[model samples]
Target chain A: MAASVRTIAVIGFDALQLYSITELIRRENDYVILDTLDEQCDIDSIDAFIITPSEFVSRFDLFLTKRTKTLILADKVSSVGMDMSVSVVAINSRLSEIEEAISVLLNSAECGAISNSELSARERDVLKEIASGKIIKEVADTLNISVNTVLTHRKNISAKLGIRSVSGLSVYALMNGIIK
Target chain B: MTLFNINSKLCDIIFYDSSVISVINRFGINLGVGDYTVAEICRSHNLDENFLIVIINTFLNEKYFPERLLKTYSITKIVNYLEKTNSYYEQFQLPNIERHFNLLIMKSNADDGNLHLLKRFFDEMKNELLFRINFDRQEWFPQLLQLGNTTLDEDIELDNIPESAHPIEDKLNDLKSFFIIHLKGKYDVNLCQAVVSSIIALEKDLKQNNRIRERILLPFERALTE
Candidate 1:
């Protein structure tokens, strides 16, 4: 199957830098340069953002709220005083470096988006009950929830953890101290 | 999406995608392919040229699934190819990944707790993979071989067998993402890259093999059983 094209929004670069980065990005058919990010821009559609450190800092709350993959284009990594989690690439990085950063950023963003979503309190309780070797009915009884609610929680847990198997979920729970 | 044809030169095809060398190896073809076309190689190996081309094309392009062409080949041949693929994974790919993973962990800082998690995940993935290999070897392939012989084994429960490769595929992808995105601390970049690359290679191979199993093998089995 053809890979789904990833939309990238370039923000806060000079015309020359923008042209260079756009050209670099255009080299890969898998990536399309979306329109520049503005107040009216639909941030939800963007898969990633390439922005200057200043630009990222200026709209830090927006980016953080969106939790979109953002790459900071700076002269040096240490110059950016943002969270260490945010990826910083040198402004003069090679095309390969830029591509690698975007690829890794997008990949991690996908898994992070699911994993970073903390399980709801009720989901955790259901998880704890289920991970302790309780069946769905038993889990529902123990948690004082309906069987359908327990099933919903199980589905959400699997979706969040990217683990479909009960044994895998049990292992994850044990590893994370959710269960003894 | 140019499909490799019977006239496609082996050397040229290798130059196009070096990964096809492994695919060719499964067909019992080796290096020193020197100037020979696909037909010539097939003739020398006593292999069906169409079968060879279809397999290569399937590997080369994910979208190229010639179901009719695949059915033209004998089921036994397909089973043999799949058996070789399982052996390749067990004997080469799994061990290869483990070696690189070990080196990566060794080169990494001792206090990096995430590496331990990664190792645990790898072990789990490895066990799952071996279980699949064994299942195919002991059950699936044998059952396929017994096709059209007496009544089908009622206990085989072919319909109930889940998509066995999918979880392994997901875990491999997760492993790659973890290595690239989540892994931190000082470690040998080269070793880490090696581990990631090996994982990617195995993932690609598994995907291609899955295409064969899903699109070709399963359909053929269903048609015959029905």
Candidate 2:
């Protein structure tokens, strides 16, 4: 099977460095480099965002939201202060290392996208109440939330946990010590 | 997705999607089906070729539910096929999954509590499935068989036969997701892969079985009673 082409955005590089990086990436058959990161650029469509360290620092929150798919281009001295959660590739590293970093980011992003099992605080509250044998109305009353909100949380919980049955949720709660 | 017809080579169909081997097995068709067309196999087995084709096509492609075609077949035939599928599950699929799961846990670290939770989840799922199978064998199938011939018992609630807030197939999917996402620590990758593949196969089988039951069998029974 042919490898799926990965869409990438090269951000925060000077004209000379950006040209060199884009040329190197273009030589490979499996990558499509976006022209520019402008307002019209669909951020989510890019599978991997290759950004310079200065740009990452300036827009830390934006990159943090997509940390799994973000690859930071940084020198060794500047990389020490970078968040360990995000992958870092040296600015002057060999082409192979940069390619490998992007590949790793894309792979991890795929796996991460497969399952988002973590429950939010409100979701945890709802789960605990529901798993304790409370019906939807009762859960809403306990949480001081509307019935529709409770239902929405229930749906989100099921989607995240990959479980829809109250009994299954109860078992998960008991096993995970979310509820006694 | 190829729509397999009566004249289609059974071997070619099998080669196209090997997973259909289990579907064929449920029909009492065994392997070494050398160079035989579907029609030829159906002739040898005294099977309905159209029914077999419908089942195979539905199994191969999720969107290919020929409801009109399915309703033409006798309920007895559909029920018998479903019973055979249930037997396949009880006799093979469930045990096979548990065996792989047991091996997976054994190969992992002894102190891992998450594995124990997963086993608990599996046990619950297994119980639910067995309960469903028993319900089918003891109550639902008999009622379905007696639909047009004899009146159903007044006390027997037909709607409750296959009812569950959480379907057994979804639990299998949950187990699969756990393996793929939440499972952490050192363990046997080969054994883990075996368990995941087995779960996925069973999940697919169950979903297909459900489509037949929900779309074909139940609606046919309802129409007959009406």
Candidate 3:
């Protein structure tokens, strides 16, 4: 039997962006967009919530319900540049990236496990460098390795951590204390 | 972390001076966890609020404090750890830059960074907090009334006491002093009437930043003596 189609809700301060993302999502899957948090919302029916940056922090406590999945989009997590706990789909994200994020969320929910334990020390070191706000080439130079080495380490790090996306890696590194 | 750990960490990464270390150490001890409020610190140390203002101004000087850690520590676990330290404000150390961070909002605007420095100074008041005062006042009032020489009466008068109009330390201290003075008094009708008005003002000012006000001020008021 085919898996049931899932519905995702896009919520944010930007109506145009919300509509666009919802349109893109609706084209590929069963989904809906909420213009605002209102009495009309069926809180029990939403499978996931994609919250924009400004809305994320203010409504974090309210929308972070146990039954619903959440994704946050922001420039930086905190003033100190510390990491945040939720996944972030960047504002200018590509379609493939968004689809991958949705798939990862579904897979993680289905598998009941998300691992960040398979990374090697070198791969972790590279991740730490990346976490400290360094670019891949810069990280490569600091580690006294080639640019290709750094990219390879990053790819390996993501796979081992059970996160196949850059945004996923960023959130993972932040929440896990692997990066500040 | 204490000035010592902060100093040691910087010394490990960059070179600094003993004079700066001494200054930071003294400042750390001054900020040590004691029964301190702005009034108490000013009275016991025989220092004017201007002196604290000067210290804060001096802290804004780039040569006096490093700008990097100042910004980073504000929104991180560093401030949390620093509060727990037995010696936080005794001495001063510089990491590298000249800047300050606003602890309350965790923002580091570059212009006159006085707001940021004052925010950290206010964070010092967190040490003595005992309980929060809110709609649940009836439940907590009995516990506190029992702990001190206070009477839990609904008719209590708070006329002479100044109401805290803001979440700033000065206002919080004023509110604390008022709470202390009214602890054992019988509710005076005339005074009770004014208190109701002040409570409304206090509630309005507190609504904007309830979490911070609750975490810092309410507990500190509870810890104050009658």
What's every prediction's RMSD, in angstroms? 15.7, 14.3, 24.0
DockQ of each: 0.07, 0.24, 0.02
For candidate 1, lDDT tens digit of each residue in B26-116?
Answer: 8889999999999999999999888888889988887777766666667788888999999988998899999988988888885846677
Models sorted by DockQ, best on top: 2, 1, 3
Off by over 4 Å in 1: A1-180, B148-165, B222-226
Model 3 regions lying over 4 Å from their true place? A65-67, A75-85, A93-99, A106-180, B1-226
What's the candidate order when arranged by decreasing TM-score? 2, 1, 3
How does model 1 fare in lDDT? 0.75
| lDDT score, candidate 2, position B194 | 91
Model 3: per-residue Cα lDDT at residue A21: 65
Q: Estimate each model's TM-score.
A: 0.60, 0.66, 0.26
Q: State the DockQ, from 0 to 1, for candidate 3.
A: 0.02
For each candidate, give the interface RMSD after superposing the true interface residues on Cα: 3.8, 2.1, 20.9
Name the lDDT value of residue A56 in candidate 1. Answer: 86
